[model samples]
Target: MYSISFLIGFSLLAGFAVAASPDVETRSRRVRLSASVIALASVLLALFHLASGPEFFALSPGVLHVLDWMFTIGGVGLALVLLYFCRRIVAREWYIPVLVVLQTGLMLSAEFAEVTPEVAHPFYIDSFTVLMTLIVGVVGGLICIHAIRYMQDYHAHEKTVPNRQAAFYFMLFLFLASMFGIVFSNHLLWLFFFWEVTTLCSFWLIAYSGTDEAVRNGFRALGLNLIGGVSFAAAIAWLTFGPGLHTWELDQLIAAGSAMALIPAVLIAVAGLAKSAQLPFSSWLLGAMVAPTPVSALLHSSTMVKAGVFLLVKLSPVFYDTYAGLLLSLIGGVTFLVTSLVAVNQRNAKLVLAYSTIANLGLIVMCAGVGTAGAMWAAILLILFHAVAKALMFLAVGTTEHLIGSRDIEDMEGLVYRRPAMAAMMLVGILGMFLAPFGMLLSKYTSFQAFLSMDVMLGDGLMLATILAFGSAPTLFFWSKWMGKLVAMPRRLPPGTDPIPRDEAIALVSLTLITYVACALFPLADKVFVIPYTDYLGALGLIPVVAASIPWDNIAIMSLMLAGLFLMPLAFWLRPPRHAEVSGYLSGANVSGSASYRGAMGVERVVESRGYYLSGFIREDIMMRYGMLGAGVLIVVMVGGVAL
Candidate 1:
């Protein structure tokens, strides 16, 4: 099944290249084809897994040995090819073909070899693996498709001297290939190699524009990720030498979960935290915003950050019952709360998205730390839902920026009048982040429930986490406010001043549709995937499943959404008094526009409202210093605690 999936993915990439050759056209064709193939593959894979029994494939030792060599050699070959291309490919387009070929070969070999239960099947696919594979194929493919239109606009806007688009597509495909490898690989070493590939791909992608800021951000991302790479290497080495840790297979590692496993587990968690952009190391992800909007969407939603959480979830059973789990939970929870607060103060639309991405990831990490059936289920659902909604939101914001010539939230006030389709999509995306029935909210509720039930850490730790979790409500307020500001109606505009791009509208509409489908069918999703996965984890004793039946209340949530959607048009139709007399406080004279006042010299001054970036309170410099310090100290504590 895994091999077949890889073959399908590779075939799709080939079709993409054939359909879209010559930069602009190639990108559009590639995106559409990739998205279609990936989504189709994911659904088929999921259905296959759910319907078929466990012993679907049989393997031989000869096949296993051959597969091992294939993956190892293929991985090495890929690294060498990437390095060679980085040095030689002036246009950079050739890198994509090279990367796709190597990754597809390696992933297929690994999948086929692991299908057999005998010969210590190193790579096996379970429900969770299927879920991740689906995400990589579907969400990752969509981002690639969106990148087609995005990159064209990006270059056209900049009017650069030398076009490096070939290199861009190369790196983009390589990134996708690496993401697929990371999610599917069972060997920790193979996973780490793929993990590093993603980091390198991101570094190159982030620096694609080659501006000083872009280069700087790229290097910063590399430096931080290198730290993670080092930790990952160390964990692999330790696991290799440790007794009872004979294999690097993820399932074997989980089955061998002993106190002795704590050392490598802690190291792996550190790497996960860094990769996920947890506080103190979060600047790398925020700096990633310097990349193009599609890259940002890919990084934030489907690819890079997800790799980290994926690792944590894959290893949850190995560490969840230990003190290491407690530390991880605390760290994830704290990062979540802090980033959420910080997001409220951001004015740059991308930065706001970046912080929200970090916050959502923190929540995922926290769920992994909680390690209960419910929490893990929440994490998986959030992973799926957030990928769709956040990707759509980023793309929407990107299109809005392209149309309006700015990415500032203030500039986007009353954006609906300008780009109704994009604005409406953004509104849905925002609601998905905050409202009921959306996976994010549902997962968050499950996370809290899981955390409340855990007894791993006592009193103060529990209380602090609970407090932080509850305080997250305020974070939703800012999202609502910004979303409201974006969709608010403008008083007037020149007819047809802003026109939406056809390609961009297609991307936005597709993303929004996927999000809505996911939201509406969440119950079905629970029944099909989440419940089974949760039951598996519960059987493993990694989490306790709580049975609390809520009196089936979908009507209320659905009705509220319907009412809001209807009322918006109804209110607009009423047009309550266009010339209504409203006054400012302090007996100020009314200015020309609504809510303005006469200032000191009798000059009319517009009321300039701006959300606080809180630079003074959450300055990058201070936050980086303190956050790294805290994270470093925790690392020490985790290591020492494990050693003892």
Candidate 2:
């Protein structure tokens, strides 16, 4: 119980130590050691929570004492980070794993402590929370580890930008700490504070480069997330003054039921929509690509955006059969459709990733809005798979950009030959997002079923289902195109490069293993986390029970497909090609010795192939404008419905 207080203090104290340390080597060592420690603690805690039962930790004097010390220590850390940024003081770096440690201790203490009637209870430990902790610890720790060498290369490449690794690491840890706080806290005030902390951390990290675009994008992210912040604050105020029913506990708020919580729920859903980067508010996440890749990975995967969906999922009970729920489902469906299509027009790898991240988040948001057992089943799996796979991708692409000196898909042609390991890991990540037997695609299947069973009061089930079907086609198109680009044979010898750094390689490989392991063990995940959470909600009558089972025959096919996913790649790697290579026959006019052929005017020309990026038809700006307008209308109607 007191770990919450300790973590608050430790984060500030450790952040200060890392940010104010004079020696760079010392900082790097601290970051590595701290990150590793936190990751181990997170996994262990997840196991412990799974073995024991989920329980609430009550507030204690020790926690209050730690809060008092936090202000004193936190002020000093803030000053040091600011001073480091000003170039007046030398400092170092640390990563985000410490948050997991803090949360683990809180859960452990709660397991032993007895709840007293007099003490305030602010912590909620559950299987779902444990799952999120595992994600934050494993994924976030690897990201921090990857950043150690990445920032070195980043500063090497961007010589004009001043190195602020110290400030960067400080904010990074703070971000994770806030995430831990959000998932663990039951009280609305505590959740809001942590929520706002992530906003501040994201703004700082996104603007880290000091470039005009970076600064602009940073402010853009800040401005948009503040919308969510303000909405959250409004919801808190409404609950505080408007309804004198119960204390500001999330469970109590939900227990107030749909009619009483409708307005605040609508406000909070808007906040979720913005935070998850749905529709009009999505530009913030897209703009965030200007930041470093670790920041992108952190935000898109385990931390910032995840926090958004987490809140929405938490409020699913209130959303059931409500107009506000319809708003989320519709907006999410539209965002998924539009973003998936727009991704086809993207040439930059990170932009593709950004759009993909938004699209998947839209799917999760849609599922949460459905507020049924089957829907939540899909939502949680989507969260887990998306976190692991997307983080793997962002980190791999970050390394690739450094090696090839570009983040363009075209520039990555023949990457399988030039950077085989990176490309293979990336391929796994890409397929994991959309391919069968992978968690995301499987989760989508569950979501589709959830939609089919949608309540009549919500909206047209078929209409939403139709959007998903249309959206899925583009999802396949963009991912396959990018996959082809990565695995394509080079036209000529590519530029040479150094091997992937040890830290980056470890992070990439670890995530790659996690991707496969998670897919194979998904049934376990469903059993231990997803099913229990869904059952809890269903028992409370917060969500409806529906036909949620995947057919055994379909599972059999998927299991075989899963085998092929790894086996085909392994076979190709192990077996040598039996056929001889041949040069291209360009219009039946091939050069004997070269890849070129005689063309117009008898000039020798090289054959070239490029991706069909449907840019001409699918304009991003046009799509974004219309998508935002549509979602905006739904949001207005949702709010007005609550008010009336």
Candidate 3:
């Protein structure tokens, strides 16, 4: 079944990529068919995991050796190609590619010199891997479905760019395949190969428009991510070459618990931080807004960035409470606090999502560094809830932009009156992001508990908790502003129907419903998923995984909030105001019963309520430069901590 999952991913990927040059009808049929098969295969995969012997399978020794040679040579070639492009496009920033090439060479040398190691169970399964697969399979399939309608609108509006529909869908499927590989691979080299494939895929998708800005931003993503790839390769080299860690299997290495493993763990953590866009490295994601929104939904919410946090969380056992873990907490906490403050100063909707993504990821990383059962519990839930809410927001934003031709938060004013359905969807996403009775806030609350419970003797416990408190305040403010604008009423009604395409509607509703269902199932998920995972991984004494002690009153409070918050919009949409009536206090004669009123001179005047951006205190240039600088210095400290 595991092997079959790979086959399904690749088949769909190749089939979609090649179908690009075909007619639109042909491409649609093929994409829909492929999406079905991909989702079905994912379901089958979960079924397969239901009964297993914890088995590990690999090819014979001779075949394993051949595969090793193939991977090493192929990887080196790809690294060289990446370097060439990096230098060719941005000659002044030449050292980046050069550094990548050097790191690749060192990695290859170390790996090649090792005793021809057998690929021990090149693939395996665990509860965590299964969850990742479900995310990739389900969320990914929905995005593909949505993209069908989205690309049509995109091409209609964007005539200058070639209609590379086939190539675009192809990359999306290919990313899915790579994601499965990433979650399933037990071998180091195999994981890295899949990792770089995603990097290349992201570059292609980001640069799809072929605009100078698009191409330039794509390269920026490539260069930054390749640095991460280099770090991952270095980790593999150290694992293979360092003492008592000759194997590529993750379980084996963790079982060894060698102190020498700390450095390699740190290297992998660096790679994770970069992939997750934690601290100093979040610019690539913000720049990615230039691409289509489906791409943003995939990369930011479900698949790409999540890989980074997944790795860090998986490696929590290595550094928990140790110096390495404490250092990671510092990076995560600082990124969360800074990015949340920066998010408050954004007007662009996508940029807000981008910064919010970074901030949430930072919280996850901090939790992973805290390295307790409770923290891990919070981390997993955060990942799941975030994927649903963020994906919904991106798609809703994309639809809103198409409808109104803008992604500015201000332009969303009175959206509930204009595009009621889409506005309600956006509202649900917003509430899910910030308000109560939703998973994101629930996860953040859980994360706070995790941080507070961490041993304060480590010095990081109270510090991380403090950062989270400050970060969360700004998060509430920014989301509330957008939500307020979206729900604001306008006296003058625009005549139009909600113009959302059927496919797009399906995707949006799926994600929005997913948010609430996930919320309702939170307690059950904790017991069924979290406790079993903890038990399987051993007590580790990280935190109490006690499920029964959860507060029911809090759940009751959130349940009431969800019903009201999510349903109020539906009720409003069901019976949208027929008569444009008075909603506020104008206290005088008004021209249209709006914010404007006639003055003593009989001239009309308007009142404005512009949201705060904190421009003077937190300009983009100031925060980015400061964020990168401070993060860089602390990263050095983190690395040094690993060394000691």
Q: Report the number of the highest-TM-score candidate.
A: 3
Comparison by TM-score, 1 against 2, better one: 2
Any runs in candidate 3 off by more than 4 Å, and if so which?
Answer: 2-4, 7-21, 50-55, 80-84, 114-116, 436-438, 456-458, 491-495, 539-548, 577-607
lDDT per residue (tens digit) for residues 460-573 in model 1: 346635745654765676787787676554433413455566667777777777777787777777777677776766676655677633345764665466547534522433
TM-score of 3: 0.92
Alpha carbon lDDT of each predicted model: 0.69, 0.78, 0.77
Reference-based lDDT, residue 572, model 2: 38
What lDDT tens digits, residue by residue, belong to model 2 across residues 1-644?
Answer: 54444434455556667787787788888777767766776777677677555577765689745653453344335334433433311122111122222322332232223431122567877888889988887899899889989999999888999999999989888887788888888866667667767876887898899886887676677667766766666676566556444346777677676877877877888878888999889999999998989999999999999999988888887888766787788889999999999999999999999999999999988888888888888889899999999999999999999998899998888777777777788888887788737477778788888888876564467777888899989999999898888767766566776989998998998998898888888889888988788777777777788767778898888788667865554443345223223775576467753457887778877777799998789998899899989988988888888878
Positional deviation of residue 69's Cα in model 1 after best superposition, in angstroms:
3.3
Task: Estimate candidate 3's alpha-carbon lDDT, on a 0 to 1 scale.
Answer: 0.77
Looking at model 2, which ten-residue stretch has the lowest summed lDDT?
88-97
User: Which residue segments of model 1 deviate by more than 4 Å?
Assistant: 2-23, 53-63, 74-119, 489-498, 553-602, 612-624
lDDT of 3 by residue, 1-644 (tens): 44544644564555555466458877877777777677777777767764443445676778777877877886888787676667447665666677677667867776767464455677777767766777788788888888989999999999999988888888888888888878887887878888887888888899889898998888888878877888887777777666656767776655544264678878888889989987788888888899999999999987899999988888876666566677788788889888999999999999999999999999889988876677787788788777778888999998888888889888787888788788878887887776636466667777777777777365557778789899999999999889888777653456456468988988888887877777777766665555566666555443345442458797787788667877876765677644365745665567666667777777777755678899898887887788788887777887877666
TM-score of each: 0.85, 0.89, 0.92
